[model samples]
Target: MRLQQVLSLVRKAADDYEMIQDNDKIAVGISGGKDSLTLLHALNGLRRFYPKHFELHAVTVDLGFENLNLEEIKALCESLDVEYSVIHTDIAKIVFEERKESNPCSLCAKMRKGALNDAIKQAGYNKVAYAHHKDDVVETMLLSLIFEGRLHTFNPVTHLDRTGLTVIRPLIYMNEADVIGFVNKHQIPVVKSPCPMDGHTKREYIKNLLKQLNYENPGVKERMFTAIQNGNMKGWPVL
Candidate 1:
């Protein structure tokens, strides 16, 4: 059932945004997390039955995270017979040293994203796929609205034409619960980050705060996801 849900979302995203090509090379961004692992697994499964031919490669960035098991992620990819690559960067050091005035998460994310793009480009892949799901999009929407004074969510599809690359989110239709369930059922090896401030971040706050609202209004996240899909968001600024 988990595989089915994941495949459905991937196919839907591909069809909805024309993300896949006849002979495309896709580099999947993996962070040793549930979402990224599940995405890699699902995409590999989809490749068997997809009408057009496409290659799947897994890319991970080592952000100088403590206790990071680069070998474990490489082993998982090898078990699936997918090519894997890791880029090492001391992002934690940079974040700690340079980011004193602004929020670290935003800057760290920018650097990580840039690293992913560099890996994708260096690997000769034309497109990069991330593991952002429905709940992530909804959370980002609320975070932007409440804090950034805007109504915005990550797009299901994005084209970086200048870089001659495209970014796609295949799990945009699946929720966090589904991903967690899938990961637990499979007992996939997940490498945990050793950030002492993991749960104290603003994103975590919003997640918990939203959970309270969701308790009072069931499917609040689902409703927000629907609004993003059905709303006339074409004219709105897209990131």
Candidate 2:
């Protein structure tokens, strides 16, 4: 039942948005975590039967984590038989030493995305896929509404001007729990976040708060997810 739900969501996103195409050389941004790894695995599952003859390659930005090996990511990609690349950036040091941000997740996220966008483009892949799931979209929507005074969420598919890249999120329909379950089932070796302050961030708090709300009112999040799925979001000026 769980697998059916996940595949349903993935297929809906692919069909609804026309994300993949024949002869597409897509770069999957791998962040060495469950979300990204789960995406990689899911895409691998669908690649052969995907309506289009597309290729999946894994790319990770080395943010200078201590004891981190680019080899693990390489091996993971090799095991999957997909091409891989590791672009280095001093993000960890920059966040701690230069920015000195108490809550660095926001800035760190932006920096890492920028780096990945640039790296992927340079590697000659115009289409890049990310592992941002449904929860990430909801959190982004909440963050924008509360902090930016706008109700906006990242689209499942978007074009980044800096890199001239078409960024797609194939896992936008699956939630974090589903991703974790898939990863555990497959025994995927995922790299932990290099951040020292992983769970203390404001987004984590929001995630926990949402979880509690979901517990109190079953289907609260599910209903919200359906709302997004049903709505004509493209008509919005924000997109």
Candidate 3:
């Protein structure tokens, strides 16, 4: 997708959820993946013309993996004129070597978010942006239903009472395919994940399963997304 198209969807989600406020500073959580990079580009473009002025700051929590690199990401941020920060931590060691948890994604995610949130709070930012898109929403809802026996997904906006930081999902309206298209068209520097279990996770399973289901039953994905929007779930934006 083009930058303009990406900005349109992001703007819609932000406006619908009342995400950005004037003079608000948003910290974009950059995982060095396509989704987060696309979000960075979208929000940077949006602030250029968005009525409610806001600032964008890029952040990444390094899991202390051997192959992880941030030089290119720093260059990208410099080109976009957005400040970037990377929090270094031994999360990989704690989760894999020390704790040796069978299901490491959960613990690793908690640690990563903890580090990210601490950095955001210390920097005095009020809100943080995550790059969860339409496909992620559907996949998460399916995961909850199949595992937890509930029909639920994340909200576009969430307030973390403990950290006193609000989280926003401006890319909630975007599809993963479009995100890939944007990254390819713009030649965005996407750093490959250094984690050992990058593609071997429950979410990856659900992603492929959803793809097959959509192929067999056309429009199922869109229908599911519509259901999420109209499901009247708590914390969902009422448009």
Poorest stretch of ten by lDDT in candidate 2: 230-239
RMSD of 2: 2.6
**Model 2 lDDT tens row, 22-74:** 88888998888888887777787788676778888888888888867566777
- C-alpha TM-scores of all predictions: 0.93, 0.90, 0.99
Clash numbers, per candidate: 0, 0, 0
Lowest lDDT sum, 10 consecutive residues, model 1, at: 230-239
Flag regions of model 2 displaced more than 4 Å: 1-8, 234-239
- The C-alpha RMSD of each candidate to the native structure, in angstroms, is 2.4, 2.6, 0.6
Over 4 Å off in model 3, which ranges?
Answer: none
Q: For model 2, what is the error of residue 118's alpha carbon versus the real structure, in angstroms, after optimal superposition?
A: 1.1
Q: What tens digits encode model 3's per-residue C-alpha lDDT throughout 1-239?
A: 89999999999999899999999989999999999999999999999999998988999999999899899999999999999999999999999999999999999998999999999999999999999999999999999999999999999999999999999999989999999999999899999999999999999999999999999999899999988998898888558
Clashes of 2: 0
Supply candidate 2's per-residue lDDT for 163.
71
